[model samples]
Target: MGTFKIEGGHQLKGSIQPQGAKNEALQILCAVLLTPEVVTINNIPDIVDVNKLIKLLGNLGVKIEKIGKGSYTFQADEVDLEYLESDAFKVDGRGLRGSIMIVGPLLARFGKGYIPKPGGDKIGRRRLDTHFEGLINLGAKFRYSKEEQFYGVEADRLKGTYMLLEEASVTGTANIVMAAVLAEGQTTIYNAACEPYLQQLCKMLNRMGAKISGVGSNMLIIDGVESLGGTDHTMLPDMIEIGSWIGLAAMTKSELTIKNVSWNDLGIIPSVFRKLGITVEKQGDDIHIPAHTNGYEIQSFIDGSILTISDAPWPGFTPDLLSIVLVVATQARGSVLIHQKMFESRLFFVDKLIDMGAKIILCDPHRATVIGHDFKSTLKAMTMTSPDIRAGISLLIAALSAKGTSTIQNIEQIDRGYENIDERLRAIGAKIERVE
Candidate 1:
């Protein structure tokens, strides 16, 4: 396993550019299978999970070409449907959580789609029922193999229908949208996830000849097209990563500028960080975070109640950044409660921070109360293991701000999301190195 050796208490300078959104890249990469024409995608982050999906597509006979750094052209005209039944596919498909998305496009274009039980972060139970259930609602026959833990869907031609999702799942919405774009009639999805990532997928499909409306709303209307054509698409900056950088700057008392951050799409990220007493200044499209030399103070409610930051559907704070917020609150001037509503196990990483001398109360599996040391007490460095992608980055941020050196094992978790993170941190005067 790879590890990161970080020298803590060093202030980072200069600016860092957020990579392409990992969540959006996964959805957009799966959309390439919806068309036979050449689909050129730019700003593809060179990360493990995205690369794994790209390789999985190539193995399935999608012709992939590297046009430039963070750019790729894919053509799925000759996809080998037979490969889905092979043992190699079972192993390849199991490696990525995003591989489940390919089933929607394959079932829409071809007659069948199969996938092994996809694997990803061990945060909690991320059920695939949403994906399969949405596909089943689109006239696809769904079957599961208990012995093999594999899922398969087949249909002659999908007929569109209205669906009100039980939960506003981002991947579920994206998967259903991809399948509905090629269905026989109009498909209306209510209570859908309206995150910018899903909006990007809808827009990209529209550009490729799919009729989709309600670009940034909870309800989406997709009219089935006979076939989709190819088009160029660029991914937006990763808001989660941008939020991480903001937290990192505040925690380490650094002046770092995050460039090209698509301010309008950031939703409540900046405001949430500001609630924790961090300065998130807007410089055109970039975010400039000044050094918090005196530490930041958490804001209270208008009624003078303690601040509670929770994750919800779009327009609310993202669950992925809650870990970063928890870590940043460790050194803030006041207290804040981080409620992770989506995932149950994400708050388990607080013990590691507590080991580092941060006053954190693990309220439960879903919530954590952080009593900010206010920089009067620096976190002492310690060795730790990364449990998941967001937690890993949060730990890395904690390590960077702690006193003395720290070691983080299983950095592959971090690499799965951030591209060249250590190298990128080094560019901004951060003392981080990758150790094999």
Candidate 2:
């Protein structure tokens, strides 16, 4: 575990770049296993979870080469199938939730995939039922062992078919798509997740010779292909990190410019912050948020009801950014209700903000009502432990605006997503130090 010692009440100034998308990197890294040819990827985020996946791929006998900064070529010419049943794999496979995605590609290519119970942030009940059911809907045989605590899927040959998912799970959809790309027939997936990450994965698969239509829509059609080849891919910028920076600038009265933020892909993120009365200026591909020393104000709905910010699927505000919204609202002029619909326990971290002198009502496990302090009362610094990745970043933003020095422990959760976060904040004039 590491700690971040931060001196608060400093107005940050200057530009910072958001790292490559963490979610997309996980999918793209798993996609490399679909093909035996060389697949080159750029803009890979240097984060803990992603590095763990890359190491797992290497251990699986995939030839990985770092061609440049944030660029790598993966060639899966040979894979050790026996490693999946090894003790070392059971430990490494459970390190992150994204590790489960490899099953689809492995099953598609080799007719078998195995994973121990994947472990990640305890945000909510993130079920793997969708992944297993989707694969089972195809020709795959799925089995689980309670004593061994592992899941295994095998198919002599996968035959694609039409199926409506129980939910439009992003990872589930990606897993199924990876499996279906090499099946015998056409696979039509309705109510599929159409996020940019999925769209990127579909495009990369298409570039690798798989025929997938409906790139940006809920309906996806994938035609079976014999084999996939190599292709070059570059990941989009981290939209969650961009939103985090926007909130950080407003809460800390900082003038910050986030460079190359991929404005088109950031659906409803900027507008959601604007609804909270935060100023977001678009300069081509960058976003510039001026200092907010005067404090931000929350806007009421058209009917004049209290503002309520909730998370939904794509084109809806991401559940990942709700924590940042909740933290930023602590300094706004009016009260707003943050409803984290996707995750149940994500709102529990508001107690830390309440301890910092912010007025927040934890209505339940899913929602929090934030009564903005309006900068009239300064938040007192305090020591806190980060509960998860998003909550950790939210606490970091709050600490940047606090009255005195603060320490945040268990920052490994934050490191699992953001790349060199302490160093990046320091480059933007934030008084943050990473202490071991």
Candidate 3:
């Protein structure tokens, strides 16, 4: 296992650019299978999960070429359908949760799709029912193998229909949209997730000759096309990483510039950070966070009630950044309640922060109450293990702001999402190093 050795209490300077959106890249990469023509994608982050999916595709006979740094050309002209039944595929497909998305595109273009039970973060139960259920609604036959823990969907040809999702799941919506684009007729999806990344996927499909409307709304209308052609696409900057950098700047009292952040697409992220008393200034397309030399104060409700930050669907604060917000609130001027509505065990990392001398109350599996020390007390460094991707970055931020050196084990979790994190942090004067 890889680890990170961080020297705490050092202020970071200079600028950092957010990598391509990890969530969007996963969806877009899967979409390449929908067409036989060449699909060139730019701004592909060099991360473990994304790379794993790329390798999986290559093993399935998709021709992949590296055009430049963070750029690739993929052509699924001769995909080997027989490879899906191999033992090698069962092991590779079980490595990451994103592999589940490939089923939709394969079932659309070809006649069958199969995947092993996908694996990802141990945060909580992320059911694959949404993905399979949506595909089943599109006239595909679904079957599960209990002994093997594998899922398969097959259809001679899919016919479009209307579906109201049980939940506004981002991956679920993306999977359904990809399948519906090649169905027989019009498909209407209500209660669809309207996240920026999903919207990007819809737009990219449209450019690829799929008829899709309501690009940025909850109701999506997709008209089946006979075949889709390849198109060029560039992914947006990862908003979650941008949010993390903002919290890191505030926690360490640093002046940092986050360049090329799509300001308009970052719905409610800046405002939520502002509620926590952090300065998120806009400089054209970039975000400039000034040093919080005197610490930040949380804002109360108009009725003078305590502030509570919760996650919801689009246009609401993202649940992925709640860990970063929780870590930042530790040194703020007042108290705030972080309610992680989507995942249950994300708040379990608070005990590690508490060990570092931060006053935090684990209200339950879903919520945490942080009493800020207002920087009057600095967190003492300690050794810890990363629980997940977001929690790992949150712990790294906490270590960077603590009083002494700290060690974080299982940094591979952090590497899955953030591209070249330690190297990027070092460019901004952060004292972070990667060690085996």
- Clash numbers, per candidate: 0, 0, 0
**lDDT tens readout by residue for model 1, 186-252:** 9999999999999999999999999999989999999899999999999999999999999999999
Cα TM-score per model: 0.99, 0.99, 0.99
Off by over 4 Å in 2: none
> For residue 163, what is the lDDT in candidate 1?
93
Per-residue lDDT of candidate 3, residues 1-436 (tens digit):
9999999999999999999999999999999999999999999999999999999999999999999999999999999999999999999999999999999999999978999999999998898888889999999999999999999999999999999999999999999999999999999999999999999999999999999999899999999999999999999999999999999999999999999999989999999999999999999999999999989999999998889999999988999999999999999989999999999988999999999999999989999999999999999999999999999999999999998999999999999999999999999998998998
Worst 10 residues of 1 by lDDT: 124-133
Instruction: Supply the TM-score for candidate 2.
Output: 0.99
List lDDT for all candidates, in order: 0.95, 0.94, 0.96
Return the lDDT, model 1, position 262: 98
Clashing pairs in 2: none
Model 1, stretches more than 4 Å misplaced?
none
